[model samples]
Structures are given as structure tokens and as C-alpha cells.
Target: MSTPNRVYLARLAGVAVFDPNGDQVGRVRDAVARMRATQRPPEVVGLVAEMPMRRRIFLSINRITSIDPDGVVLGSGTLNLRRFEKRPNELLVLQELLDRRVQLDSGHAGSVVDVAMECSRGGEWALSRVAVREHTGRLTRRGHLHQVDWDRVHGLGAVGDNRGTANLLAVLEDMRPADLANALQDLPDARRNEVAAALDDERLADVLSELPEHDQVEILAALDRQRAADVLEEMEPDDAADLLNELPPPEQDVLLDLMEPDEADPVRQLLRYASGTAGSVMTSEPVILPPDATVAEALARIREPQLSPAVAAQVFVTRAPLTTPTGRYLGMVHFQRLLREPPADLLGGIVVNDIDPLRTSTPLPEITRRMATYDMVSMPVVDRNNRLVGAVTVDDVLDHSLPRDWRDRDAVSPSSATHDGILDGDDE
Candidate 1:
């Protein structure tokens, strides 16, 4: 038979798969590939399908008889593929990848959507992290087309097997920190701490920030004083301060000592602020530029791969000796504005000082009101000295204060409360 055109899994995103006689099987939910134990092209392991009634099923690649751009051709007739079940000593299917974060070859990052299972050559069923999908569109179209092998999985957590429950604690004992952090989120608090305690300072720090404050406290309390301090020091100052606030004074003091003076000082300052304050939430890590810098220079800095979106968005403009330490606050230039203007224009020319700014101490209500009033995505937080301290975006405020259901529940009312009631009884 002639080989069909090389159709990529990405291009087949919305395509359908059919049986040999051309009966519809299912739509292609996702294509999965597994890394070979030895050096070899990762084999297409299976395809996840969105079946009828919102049900999902996995079809093994071995059952595929042909491939075409239009749809996948399966060798089997229309039959529901059997789901792999976890047996004694077998890895849990769902636990292996469910909710654990993964990096796709395409540079997009996301947690596992679901795992695909199939029976291996020896008549035993196997589970693997086959498909990864991201919620964000950070990676471009070309980047999204690439696929990675399961072996390339840099990190993973102790996920349960196909069974509802398994001994994940034992599996977590040997995993790395980031992987453990990803996995611990789904585990009970007790098991999560057990896995956290085994992580190194850096890994613990990374994982701690990803967890909720309650979990952070639980894990921190379980760690030895020295290890806990080391982890706090490695974390961002704001994050460290947040965690420290949850600890008792004596423990907090000891952890502070473990951090370098430079790292400890800023964190201590942040700790002094109230929770939910801009000062407590903001990172001092921002890009500062002088008003004299050409739009070209600012654009270059923003475009650099090293700078993150948050840092790149608001470019601060200062006075001429571009590096003038005491230059008066000019204004902020947004990326959208910068992109619209010529690169050669001076940043000062584009500066708009009339913008609304927020004080570090501003309450959530006021901050939200200002955001809504100005129709702003983010507002810069500054101190009494007019020095930029942090920023609060609309998302940050809404995450805390926005009503889940703001629509009027009482909008629908009875037409009459008195006379109509009696009239209805008489009208039959």
C-alpha cells in the first residue's frame, strides 16, 4: 500500500478516525508517543478519543492500519477499547501524570490533561505520559507542532496507578523537588510533607511557592530549622516573607539567620507589610530605564528573551544621564504604546505622568475601584517618597475581591404581591 502523506498530530487536531471499512470510530482527541528504552524514534503509542456521551477512550497505535490527512484508519471494527486497570506491582495509570506539570517540546508549559493506556507486547497493560496540553498560548503554531518522548519528561510526581489508590508515598521518596512539588499538590497534606522534607533547599523553595499558604506552612513546619531556612532564603523575597508570616517568631528568626543578609533583609521588609498589600506581593525585580533612552533601546530590552512579560510591560522612565540615580519620576510607558511608536523616539516624549498610581497601602476596594475607573489592566504601586515599589493588576484584585456571581439574583420579581393573588383564585 502507498504511504499516505506525512500528516502531523497537530494538523490532525480536529480530524476523525475511522475503521477499516470506513465506519466512524471517533475523533482524534490527542496523539501520544512513548520514548524507547534504547535510542530509537519515539513510537506512536496510542490516540486518545472523545467518544459519545463525553466519554474518553484510548486506541492503541498497533490497532491502526493506515494514516491519512483526512483521518486515521483503524484495523479494528467499532468496539470500545478496554481501559487498562492497575494490578499489584503495576504503576497507577491516572496517578502517573494526572495534574502533574510537564513541559512540551514546543516550549509551552502545562499540567497533564490525561493519560493514555494500552496493553504492551507481553500481554501486560502499561501506562505512560503520552499527551501534554497547555492552557496558555505562549508557544507559537510551529512550536506547538513538536512532540516529546515520555523519557524526555524531566520531572514527574508520585501519581496513583490505574487503581483509585496506590502507594504513592514510596514512589515520591526518590523523585526530584520540582517533580515532587507538582505531584504533592494532589496528595494529602501528610504525604505531601513527607515528600517535601526530602527535597533540597532550592527545590523545596520552588515547590513551596507553588503551593497554597496552608500547605506551605504544613511543609515548612515538618522541615528541620536549618533546612527550612535554606529553602526560604532560596525563595523570592516576597514569597519568603509570606511563608515567614505563617511561622512563629522563634522559628521565623532561625530561618532568617539561614538566609543571606541580602536575601533576608528584603524578605524581612516584605514580612512587615500586611498580607494582600502591594508591598507584600510585589517583586523588586523590574527593569528600570532612563527617559533619555531611545524607544529602540527600550524595545530591545523588552524583546530580550531573558526578560519576562511582567518586567517588560512597564518601563520606568528616569532623567537624562539615563542612569541618573535621583532622576525625578517621569512616567510609565506601556509595551503596547511603545510598539505603536517609532523606535527612534525618546521615551520621555512618550511618557504620560497623568496616569493613576496606587499607594502600597491602598486597600483592595480602592484599588479595584481605581482599576475599574481607569479601565487599566495594571497600576503601579509607589511609596510616599514617589519611588516605585510594586504593581497590582486587575487580575490580582479580582482574584481576591470580585464577586463570583455579581448578576442580580433578585431581578426577576412577581408582578403583584397582593391584588393579583386574590384575582388568580377567582379566575379559575
Candidate 2:
């Protein structure tokens, strides 16, 4: 192999993986290592690479002919295509070990910044070195970064707890919220909570909404009550309500009490509606406007960077009081219609109400059928008095429609069943 003797795992992240023909296959997501019961260094086994369509597959160390900052070259193009599942004795270097709090043999306390795997002359690779950053409680002065033998660190044997998340979060900063949430699922319970708590409220809220409900509740429970409530505030009201619904009523009341009343109100309203109803799944904060609002104004509102594509696809035009439960709901104007109309044109003229709006009590199946039939990205939900209460997006419907464990690691992904690639091992 032409690979370097020692390579830091963090630097390998995002490096492209290619076949013998040099065609790009996937990118490195994490490295897999087999752990031992003793203090011996862990053996480097393989890599977890995310292939097309977000399918993560394992590539055995023996299949690689080269490894560098540029890319990892596979000896063969055939990939097993099996979704990577961590064995009980295996550790995911980047996911579980980065930022691990450790105690050096010399009595210095620090956290892991990176781990390096070294290849021996005898043709075996093992985790041999650790880069740790010292822990300094002061904010003004920076801590020293130390490079030491892996055996010198005390905490790598177990998953990290109370570790700094700066290094791990930096690697994940570029990931989309859904991808980040999926990555979070691969981490150990304590490590997941640490990373979740470290994220800013808005980022955490986005990630939380993408996670499975059980994982969402666990991470939330691990946070400080005040912090958790703040994160809930940052999530869409529907998402926030869905997460809260996973908890017991008493616990939900505590978090609700901590949130700002305005943010809590919509969530409370969502909670009152029966499960699987439009009212329970709709977002109370969809783009809303009065019929008199101009096309340009509607365009500008939807253009806000914070709005999701589905929510921004259209605008709900209602009477006085733009907030939910506002005066009579007039109708809605899709962004496409807004673009066709003159900028000065009033939304009232172009507003579309030909398709009747969904009532708060509409069941999930009916809402799904209507949205699909109308080819709508979002549908407005009105109360009995015709007041705009909320709007449900296609994403909401899909989230509810999927099996509860759809996000679990064991869940079968679309491409998981294929095994076009060779998974040859010595035993096989």
C-alpha cells in the first residue's frame, strides 16, 4: 500500500472514496476500529463511507489500496452495499471518540481532538496516537494541544461524557440538519446528548425535528430544563408539539411554562387537537398575509432564509389579525402565482381558494389524499369559524405516514437490500 504510516481520522473526513477505475463512489464519513478488553491499542478495521442516495456502506481495510488527504482508492469497484452497522466491540472514531474527555497518565486533563491510525511493517493498522487539547477553565487564555501515545489517555476505552463538542461540532457544521440528525443517531447515548446540548438552539431544533421521536425525547431530557424549553421555542410549533407529545403531560407542562407565552400558545393549541388530525400536525407559523398585500411583499416574505421550501411555496391570505386564529381565512396565493402577477398587484385578485381548505378535524389520511390530489405542497387548516389556524406541509404528512422506527439504524433503507459489491473476507 502507498498510504502513509499514520493518518489522523478527522482529516480523512469528506475525502472522496473511489474504485480502481478512479470513478468517485462515496465520501468518508467515519473509521471503524475493533476495541479490546485490555489496554492494547484498537485494530483499525474499515471505514464507513456514504455512497449515493445517502447509503452508508462499510469498506474493509483490506479493500483499500491507497489513503491520503486527496481520496481513498478501493482495490475493487465491487461494494457489498450493506448498510454499516457497528458491532458491539467496534468503535466509530469520529462519531464516538472525538472530543472525548480524557485524563493523561501525567495527571493532565484534556479532551481528544483527533486520533491517528498507524500501519505496522507487519501489515496491520492500529490506533497509535492521540491529539488532545488541554482543559483550561479560563475563557481568555487558550489551552495547549498535546500529542501523546493513545495508551496515555484514560477515557478512550469508554464513550465520552462531559466532553467539549467544539471539534466534533466543527466537523458536522456543514452537514444539513437531517444529515446531522442521522449522524447523531450513530453516537452513543451520552455522546449524543453532549453534542445536542452543545449546538445552538436553532441548529439543535432543526436537528431534533429530523430525529426519531424517542431519540428526540432522550436528548431533550438530557438538557437543562431551561435550555430544552429554549430549543423547543426554536423548533416549528408543530415539530415542538410532536416532541412534547412523546413526554408525559406533567413534564410537558414544565417545559411549556419555561417557554415564552407566545411560542407556547400555538404548541398548546396543537396539543388540544386529537392525534392524527390536521390541527395536530400543521405549523402555526406558515407565511401569512392579508388579501391586500402586494405580490412583491408576498415574494419578499417567502424569500426569508429561515422559511422551509414547502412553507414558503405559498402564502395564506386572511382577514384582520395575521396570527393564527386570525379573522376569517380568505385563501392562499402560491409563489408561482405571485411571480406571474405584476409586483404591484394585490394578492386578493390572484389568491386561490378554488380547492377548499382543510378543517382542523380533518384526519391524516384525508389530508394526505387531498394534498396529493391537489398537487399542493401545503394546505391551510381553518377552525370551525373559518379562522386560519395553521398550514400542513408535505413533509409533515410524510413524517406521520412513515413507521415510527423509520429513522432507526436497523431500519431498512431503500438501497440496503442490494449487495452488488463484493464483501470478501479471509473467512469468506
Task: State the lDDT of candidate 2 residue by residue for 17-132, as single tens digits.
Answer: 99999899998999989998788899998899988756688888888999999999998545787887777788888887888899899898988899999999898889999999
Q: Report lDDT (Cα) of residue 324, candidate 1.
A: 14
In candidate 1, position 407 carries an lDDT of 17
Model 2 segments more than 4 A misplaced: 1-5, 19-25, 35-40, 51-55, 102-109, 120-123, 149-162, 413-428
lDDT of 1 by residue, 1-428 (tens): 12233333433444677877887866764455444465433444556554442233556655676665688777643444433222232232333444456666656665554443333454323343345545465555322322345555534433432221222333343443434454565455665666577666776787786555667888888887777778888886666876788788887888898878877877776677676676666554445678778888888888886444655776777544332122455678888898899989998889877975677777777877887887776677767766666566554565446342221111112221211111223210
lDDT of 2 at 391: 95
Off by over 4 Å in 1: 1-182, 188-191, 194-204, 303-308, 319-327, 398-428
Quote each prediction's TM-score. Answer: 0.52, 0.88
